[model samples]
Target: MRKRLSAQIAARRKQQVPADLKGMDASLMAMLDAQIGDLEQRIKGVIEQEAASAAKARLLLSIPGIGPVSAAMLIAEMPELGRMTSGEAAAMTGLAPIPHDSGAMRGKRAIAGGRRALRHVLFQAALAAASHNPVLKPVAQALKIHGKPHKLVIVAIARRLVTIANAILKTGIPWQPQPDS
Candidate 1:
């Protein structure tokens, strides 16, 4: 609803709209902003209410590209994170590239199924990781250098992010930078 309203506001700006329409849009935007803030606060409160969840949240937050929202999403949406293998984690989030093949016919690999909402959250995290994560930044850059499409690069980064998150959770360790090679 907020995104739709934002689009409506943008479209309104392109026209000579009435003053009342402008005022309505402003009011709706303000209301939506307040609700979003409240929701975020509620999510934080829920995470902190459980000792185990709080610990998991801390571990997730230690990752460079994952912020509070992403951590919350992971904790809430993907409860099986720590118990699974890295490939299983990626597959659960729909970041795993599935193969398409048959008798004498091979096709491109694509990701499918799993928790769609969690996948979007991971994609957003991957976008941040591509820019800021010490380990992932070089991988993203190298993919770009090789002329991979932007979506492909981001998907790759997202897969890696889930794998790292899974490993960290499984081991109960905060993310630590690798030593210089």
Candidate 2:
């Protein structure tokens, strides 16, 4: 909405816009920015006050691409992280590919039927990991070389991320990136 409003304000400025309209756009943008900042601060305070959440967030932040928001979301939404298998973790995040095959015909696999919100958040994190994570960058590049769609590559990375999260939490150790053999 802020971006939209800014675009609208720019467009209006190009035309003959009144001073009042410009002021309104500026005020709205300011309010939106303030509200976003306030919410982020509140979230930080709440996370810090909760011992378990703080621990989880710290563990998650040890990973290359996982940030505070993603860590918080994972802690809040998926409490079963450490207890699950990699496949289970992937399925929980809706990153596991589901196969639909009829008799005598193999069907293409696609992901579906899991926590939608977590899936979206994981995808966002995966996008960052694909570009920046040394551990994940090669995996992403391999998929790209094979002609996988951008979305598919990200989903694969998201699945790997959930698996790694599970391992880290279960072992109570921060991620230590391994050099490629």
Q: Which candidate gets the maximum TM-score versus the true structure?
A: 1
Those runs of model 1 whose alpha carbons end farther than 4 Å from true positions after fitting are 1-20
Candidate 1, residues 13-115, lDDT tens digits: the string is 5777587688886786677667777778888999999999999999999999999988998998899899999889999999999999998899999999989
In angstroms, the error of model 1 at 9 is: 8.5
- Cα deviation at 164, candidate 1, in Å, is 0.6
lDDT of 2 by residue, 1-181 (tens): 3335445556755675477788776686576667666766788799999998788788899988887767878997899999989999999888889989999899999999788878887888999999888999999999999999999999999999989999999998988989668
**Candidate 1 lDDT trough over 10 residues, lowest sum:** 1-10
Model 1, global lDDT: 0.90
Q: Report the C-alpha displacement of residue 144, candidate 1, in angstroms.
A: 0.4
TM-scores for every predicted model: 0.90, 0.87
**Candidate 1 residue pairs that clash:** none
